[model samples]
Structures are given as structure tokens and as C-alpha cells.
Target: MATAEADVPTAALKVERGKKAPQFKGRDRWVFYAMVGIPTGLHVLLVWVPTVGSIFLSFTDWKGIRFSDITWVGLRNYNQIFTVFEKDFFQALINNTVLLVFLFLGPTLFGMFLAYSLDKSIKGTRLYQSVFYTPVVLSLAVVGFMWQSVIYSTENGLATQLFGGGEPVDWLGNQSFLISFGDTYGISKNFAAILIAIAWRHAGYIMVLYLAGLKSVDNSLKEAASIDGANEWQTFRLVTFPTLKPINVVVAVITVIEALRAFDIIFVLNTPRKTEVLSILTTNNLLGEGGGNVGRGSAYATILFLLCLGFVIWYVTNHYKSTEEGAES
Candidate 1:
């Protein structure tokens, strides 16, 4: 049989191989190229091109008018941000830092806990998931309006009804310093309120992410861990959590992006005092009344881009390094 197989003609083998493998030609080839090329082209055109343009504009002085009006300023915009408008810049930066910290501590952890709890096939789990994730589906603008009008309203709002005791508490207006730092910057009461609104929506978003991750976790590992006398927490931390590294990475990146780019809800709330984030400052400078300063806006955008890029690079590098170490071990 080996001799007969070896004696098979090369042309016959080639014909058999050709029967199994097909090649794209004409229309199919064009379709395949379109499927890949269009999206890549659009992404480069819409995302990267604008990013490069922003970086270039960050080093120039322009009123966002005629191209001839542009003048190269060589870090002048950055210098002014640090010197002339340092107060606003620092205030926004602090607010952004606070937001990033809060999201990680509050929503991210809470969402993971919720996902774990819901993954146990408990009664009414679907209903609970729907209820928790409902806020995430709503537009942030709509969420802002809903929270402002119904939940946090000074008059007849649920929050005031529950906590005010009698005097109406301005959930979205009062800017009293809750955590003061000298006379320059502080976490204001209104900003804290906005944080709550942000947390409400963000928690649901995070819960969904973690829930999906949990669903994809293997049951056998969990069963084996249980059989080994590991408690729920231990099993999760060791077995389940380890399996969730990809999900963790995604969640971390998303949390960072969300915290850094937080704008819609705050903007919808008309950007309460002391609640200004980098995005808010960027928008105000880029599109503020009276012509607006393109250079300053681009500088703010560049700063934001750098911050986001820095975190992504750090996290990704650490993740890969740890992964390689684990594999080697």
C-alpha cells in the first residue's frame, strides 16, 4: 500500500489538492479587499489623521480660522497652559485624577462583585442583570437629564426626599468645598454629585463586561477548586480570576478611557463648578464663544492624548511582561 501510494502521479496529487483549496478571483477578490480596506481606510482617515492634525496644531497659534492665520508657536501653548491658565489646568487635571481613582475604586469593583454574585445561577438573575444594565443602554445625556430632574432634583427629588430631611439639598448646583486643599483647589459638593451620576451609569457598563467575562470562565476549574476545599473567594481569586486576565485588561483599559474622556454627563449637567475635566476644558477652548483658541484646545487635547497613551502603554507592557513570566514559569 505504501509503494502504491508513493507511485501515485504528481499531477493526481496536485489535482486533489486543488480540489480542496479554492482561490478568490475577480468579484470575490474585490469583495474581500473592500471588507478589509474600507474600514481600515476610514479608521485612518477619521481617527489617526485627526490625531496627527491635533498634535501638529498643539504646537501652533491659530484662531481656528483661515489656514494662513496659523503660526508656529513651539510649545508656547503648553507653556501658557502651565503658567497663564495654570489654575484651570491644574483644577481640571485634579478632577480627572479623582475621577480615574473613583471609577476604579467604586464602579469597577462593584461591577465585578455584581457579576460574581449574578453568575451563580441565582433566582431572578436575568431580571437583576437587566435592571443593573438598564442605565448603561441609556445615553449619558439622557441619564444626566433623568438623574438631574428625578433623582437629584433639589425640589421633590428622590435624593433630597431621602437625605434632605427638610431643606432642599442642591445635588447639582452647590459648589461648597467638600475636600479643600488650601485656597486653590478642592472637591466641591456639586462635583461629588456628578460623580454619583457617573458611577450610576458606569457601574452598569462594568457589570456587563464582567458578567460576559464570568460567563466565559470554565466550570471544571471552579469545580476542581471547590473539590480541593477552596472557598468561594479563594477559588475566584486563584482559579477564576486568573482565567479572566484578558477581561481584566479590557476592563482596565475601558475604565481608564472612560475616566479620562468623561464629558457627556458633566456637559449635560452644564459642567457644574469645579467639575471641569480635561475634556471639558478642551471643548470649551476649542468651541468656546468668540472665535475660540485652536492652539490652546489642541494643547489640551494633546495632553489628554498623552495621558491616555501613557496609561495604555504602561498597562499593556506590564500585562505582556507578566504573561511572559507566567508562561516561562
Candidate 2:
């Protein structure tokens, strides 16, 4: 009788406690809704709205000024940009592409080299790093002016001293040089000038990025490589490069964007010889460099936007694929 009475009370207490507890299943529902709402609302307002507006403008002949007057021109803008007046469009594309090629090879590779060298103990490392990064802080307008004087000034330009065969040749003004730039330097003066300028600006940034990646590499793997009778080159090849693959991916994406969207430097490089690029070219066309063409400018911008999007998608997809493969292995 005593045991049965004790068991019955214990069961009753358990049931009462269960009933008194609060359910946590739906308690944080408000937090999820709030988070989703804010970002989605902002994206709709900022990105989607502007994108749709630009697309609409592309379909019409709208001078960016005075929205009161706008004409709708279907595919006329795009057709002219690609076919009728292709010189400006194609040339700008080529110049930007050339800059991009150099950017991918020069800064990325050289920066890796510099970072690897600095990975060893060296004197004046901080000073070197500071000096290298100084260019990145300067505005493109300032750099362009400084470099133009150095490259274009026949009497006082540095290129004149080294390359002009005793006198400075107007690097941009001389059509002969542009004609033969490929013959001599394997790239045009516009190509070389922009390549040098961008390298000076971004090389240090790449070095710093690589340095960070280098630091995260496991010290033990390196030591193991060394212990296994591996030389420094072998160790770096086997251990360091593999570790840096992810950093290279980031560097590539940044370099590609910088190359394509680099407007300020090329704009300031406006000489009589070659003052035109896609951004400047399109702007000049819109505002009438020779004659204003608002419809055409929008078309150029549209093309650039699509191209940038395409490359970004390509890089992202490849990056994810590589990551998945690595995970699988």
C-alpha cells in the first residue's frame, strides 16, 4: 500500500511539471522574419530598382539630362555600338583587355615572388612594404599626370632618357610609335603605360594578400618538407603553392574587375593619339565627343555590365567547383 501510494504521487508530479513548462519551438519566429525582411527590402530598393531602370533606359533614347524628353529606340543603340561604329568600341575593348592580361600576369606573379622573398627574414621589410603601398593611396588623376610627364615629356621624361635614343619621343603623340609599339615592346604605348600604372598601384596589394595567405599555411608541413631533403624551391612548389591556390583565386577576381572598370587612369591619359576607352569613349559619345549620342552610351554601359556579370559568374562557378573537388579529395 505504501509503495503504490508513493509511485502514484511521483507520476502525478511529473505530469504537472511537464504542463507548467513553456514551449520554445516557435519563440524566435520574429527574429527570422525581421532579418529576411530588412535585407530583401534594401536589395529591392537599391539594386533591383536601379537595374530595371537602366535596362529600360537602354531600350530608349534618353539623354541623361532633362528626363522631360525621352524617345524609345528599340535595338538601334545596341546595333550601332556593335556594328556601325565598332572602331571605338572594339579598340577600347582591346586596350582594356590588354591591361587585364598584364594585370593577371605581372602583378599577381611578381607580388607572389616579392611576398615569398619577404617570408624569409629580411632587413627593411616594413619600410619596403610601406614604400610599395604608397602608390595605391594616390589618386589615379595624380598618378596619371605624374607618369605622363615622365613618359611624354621629350626633354625631361624618363622614357626619353632610356628609350627615345637620346631625345624624348612623345609616347602617345607619335603615331609611328603606336604603329610600332607592338613591334618593339610587344604591346602598344597605351598598353604599356596603363600596364605600368596599374602594376604600380596594385602589386603591393597583391603582395599583402599573398603574405596573409602565406602566414596561414601550416608551419609543420613546411618543416616536414625541409626534413625530407627538399630544397627551398621544392618546398615552396610542393607546400606553399598548394596553400596559395585560394588566394590566387581572390587576386584573379580583383585583378579582372580592376582591369575592366579602370576608368580614372585611362581617362587622365587623354592625349591626342589615344584618349578613348570604353568608359571615356561612351561618356564622350553620350555628351558628344564628336557628336552626342545618349542612346549609344547606354548601350556601351549595358554591354560592360553584362560582360562584368559574365566573368564574375564564371569565376564564382569555377571557384566553387574547385572547392568541391578539393573537399572530395
Candidate 3:
């Protein structure tokens, strides 16, 4: 009877202690709250909320001037995108793709060349870096104005005095490069000029990426190849570039995203009505010609956003696939 009474008291004490144990520390509790709250709040506030709102907006005919005036329009906004201005829509898509390729592949290819060449010391390396990177610092407005003024027409412009002696050519209005060959092929001035401008601005940025990638590679491998009597080309193709796969992927993915989102350069070059990119088109509609079609504007924006997301995912996935193989090997 004494033992039984002691056991009952012990059980009671255990139960009381269980009820009174401290739950969490203040700092840890705060961190837990932050971890959950920050990401959840950001996703909801920045991405999900905006996306949901846009979907609803795309279905309405709201001018966005007043909250109470929005009206339901069903698939009309879509119809307008595909049917009313079909040419603009498709042409802009094609142009955007072209821009993506050049803005991405061009920078990748050229940056490798620049990085490889500059990987070693030469005369005035700093000067070359500055010269190449100057365009990057200039605002799109400055770039646009500079190009337009210089290439507007040879007659009044510097090119006119140099090439025509008097008559300035209307460079932007003419086809890209006039061919004198039997089979003449000329690029449109608008595309050509934009291409040059974008390339000039972004090539150096890619070079910086390539420089880092190049640095990450081990030089001992190159020395071993040279000792084996392998030529420079063979060494680079088999050794250095393979190691640079990750950097290339990173640069390409980033470049594609930037290209897809390009607006400022094109906008500064021409009026919204003239350049007519998806971004500008959305802007125009969001402001006016989209009628009171807030939904349509949102739809256009959604398309651009999706396109960028898709390309980024694709490029990054492929990039890492090769990287994983290299890592395993």
C-alpha cells in the first residue's frame, strides 16, 4: 500500500511537468515566423495576387481609370489580340524571338571571344574594357538619341560627310545593308539598327560573365595539353570550353530573360506605336487604344511574363543537365 501510494504521486508529478514544459525560444520562434511569413507573403503579395488580379482583369473591359466602371467582356480581349491585330501580334512575336537569339547567342559567342582574348595581359586592357563597356552605362535614351542623330541621314549627319560627301542616307528608313550582288538581300533598317544598338550595349556585360567563368577553370589542365603538343584550338575546344558550360548556361539564360523583357531601348528608339513590341503594346492598351480593355492589357502582359519564364526554365534545365554530367564524370 505504501509503494502504490508513491507510484501514484510520481505519475501525477509527470503529468504536471508535461503540461508546464516551455514551447519555444523567442529568437527561434521569431525565425520560424519569419521563414513562413516572408516567403508566403511575398508569393501571395507579389506573384499570386498580381496573377489572379490580371486574370480577372483580362476578362473585363475596364479602362483602369475607375474601379467601379469595369465591365465583363469574356473572350473579346483574346479575339482582339489574335484577330484584330493579328499581323502585329505574330510579327512582334517573331521579332522578339529573333531578338532573343541575337541578344542571347550573340553575346554568348562574342563574350567568349572577348574573354579568351583578354584572359591574358596586353597593351591597354583597361582601356579596351572601358571602351567596350561604355555603352552599358549609357541610358537607353542617350543611346537612342546618339544613334538617331549619327545615322539619321548622311546629308546632315557625320556619315554623310564621310561617305556621301554631301547627301546623307536615311539609314533607319532603308533596308539594313544594301547588296550590290546579283542576289541582293537587305535587312530592314529598323531591325538592323536595333540589333547593333542592343549588341553594343550588352556584349561587354556578357564578357564580364565569361571572364568569371574562365577564371573558374584550372590552368593546369591547359598546361598539360600544351605539353602534349596539342594546338591552342584543340586545347580550348576539349578542355576550357567544356569547363565553361555552367557559365555559358548562366549567361545564356540571363541574356534570354533580359532580351525578352527588353523595352527601354526599343521604346527610346521609336514611339510606342512605331516599335510595337509586346511591352509597348500592353502599355498603349493599358493607357488607351486597348479601349477600356484592362483584361486585354493584362493578357498581353501575362503572355510576355509566361514567355520569359518558359525560356528561363528551358535554358537553365538544359544547362544544368550538362553540368550534372560533367560533375559526375
Candidate 4:
């Protein structure tokens, strides 16, 4: 009886397998092919190809004009980046690092504060949110130019007219270093000016992100904390903030990326001498405006890529590990 029952189950399994796999209809199959193949082809053609080419070019002296002009120079480009052109390169690095640090310390925290306030349903809360989020809607180019002409312009900017008492202050042109690190590196006053504009926009973006995260938190948790005699600060620090881990991670990555990819604003600001960062330097070299060093530009891109990749990988791995632990617990 057991053998007969087993044979019956095996026959049913064989029958199920014999029922052919579902096939797409003629139109649906074509649609699927189009949807997948087009995007895959474009990605391979545009992103991957260019990236690989640039990496190869980084090891060679490619003028970026002719294919035949390419000549492999091994690590010479990287060598120059560290030794020969260390002045601007290191300055760019310092500026990027400073920007990253400042954004996190200033804008990210402030935005969270704003989001926390707004989440409490204050009077005219929607209006306040809109006002803060306006800058985020504007492109970096618009933000840069608007600030340049309306606030930073030496002759007639609001700041110049108001602060200088008629005589305009050269906010963007000032190359005075704020904090000097030896003779080679220091924080530029003009870079600080650009950072202000960046922070204005960045704060709004972070506020929106944090606001979303804040809204999703269970109010019951807050009530429970309050019932337990926990104050607002304690509740936030111990209960609320821990729940915002995902948003915090996202904001951290965005801040780092914005600092690294700060081009449009710096570009519109006339690529100021003192305000040059890695992105601007990379473009300057590749386009021949500064030194036409394609190899160096490629190397700079690679370094930036590595920095971003490292942060992303670390964040993703930690996020998943924590998630798995929480599930197991």
C-alpha cells in the first residue's frame, strides 16, 4: 500500500512537469524583449563602455581627441597627481573633505531639527515646509547664479549693498584663507561662500527626507515613552533616532555625494581659483581649460568613484547585517 501511494505521487509530479512552462504571447514577448533589451543595450553602450575606456585612458596619455594619440604611460599620471600637481590636487581634496564635514555638521543636523519641528503640526506647517523646500526644487545652476547676482555680486548684490554700506565686498573673489594648514593648504573664504549656497539647498532636501522618515514612526512609541516619564530629548535620542537609521544612512550618503559632485554651483561661480574641488579640477583638466591632462582627470574621477563606492558598500553591508540580526532576534 505504501509503494502504491508513492508511485501515485511520482506519477502526479511527472504530469506536473509535463505540463509545459508558460510561454509569453507573441505581443507580450516582443514587449518584454523591447523593455529589457533596449535599456540593457543603452547601459552597456553608454555607461559601461565610457567607464572602461576612461579607466584605460587613465593609465595612458590620451589627449581625448584621437584614438591613435593614446600612449600608455603606466602610473605617471597618478605619480603627477600626488607629487607634481599636489598643490591644487590636495587643495581640491581638502576642500571636498571640508565641504563633506561641514554639510553633515551644519545642514544635515539643522534639516533634521526642522523636520522634527514640522512633524509636530505647528501653525502654518505646510507653508513653512514649502518655504524651506523651495531651494531644493531649484537647480544648482539657478541657485548659484541667483546667489551670485542677488547676494554675492560685488557691485549690487543685496549683501554687498546692505553689509558694505554701498561699497561692495568681493565675496566670491576673496582668496583669503580662513584656517591655514602649512603654506600649501587652507580653507578659502570664497569656498565658504559657495558652501553657504550649497547648504541652503542641501538643508531643504534633507528636511524632506527626514520628514518622511519622521512621519512613518509610530506615535504609540512616543506615547509609551512619555508614559514611562521619558522627556522629549530622551525619547528622541533613545527611541526616535534609532528608528531613523535608514534615513540617516541615506542622508549621510547624499551629503557625501553632493560634496564630491559639487560642480554646477562651482561652475556657475566662475570656477573660482580658491573654490576649486575635485569635480571642477577633473573637468578643468579633461577639457584643457586648466592643464588638459586627460590622464590626471581620469585618475581624479577614479578616486572619487572609489570614495563613493566604499561608502555605499560599507553602508549597504552594515544595513543588511543589522536587518538580519533584528529579524533573527
TM-scores, all models, native as reference: 0.84, 0.76, 0.76, 0.86
Ranking by TM-score: 4, 1, 2, 3
Q: Which candidate, 2 or 4, has the higher TM-score?
A: 4
Q: Clashes in each model (backbone N, CA, C under 3 Å)?
A: 0, 2, 7, 0
lDDT of 1 by residue, 192-273 (tens): 9888888888888888988999999999999999999999989999999999898888889999999898988889898556
Task: Report residue 231 deviation for candidate 1 (angstroms).
Answer: 2.4
Write down the lDDT that model 2 would get. 0.74
For model 1, the superposed segments whose C-alpha errors exceed 4 Å read 1-35, 313-329
What is the TM-score of candidate 4?
A: 0.86
lDDT of 3 by residue, 1-329 (tens): 45555566555566546455323344545787888899999989998898778877887878777988888888787788899877667656766777777776686578678988888766887788788778888876687778778755435766556766576576555544332212332234566566777787788888888877888889999999999999999999999999988787787677877777777777766632224568777776756444555777887877787787777678868868988899778
* Local distance difference test values of all predictions, in order: 0.88, 0.74, 0.72, 0.86
Give Cα distance to truth, residue 167, candidate 2, Å.
Answer: 1.5
- The best candidate by TM-score is 4
lDDT of 4 by residue, 74-109 (tens): 998889999988898899999999999999999999
Q: Considering TM-score, which of the candidate structures 1 and 2 is the better prediction for this target?
A: 1
Model 2, range 1-329, lDDT digits (tens) per residue? 45545566555566546454321224234565667789999999998787667667778887667777788889988887778776667767777777788777898788889888887767988888788778878987788888888766768788778877886576655433343324422335555655687788888888899988998999899999999999999999999999888897788888888877888876677665443557776567655454455667767777777868987998889989989899778
Full ranking by lDDT: 1, 4, 2, 3
Q: Mark the regions of model 3 whose C-alpha exceeds 4 Å error after superposition.
A: 1-24, 31-44, 65-74, 151-155, 159-165, 173-187, 271-274, 288-292, 315-329
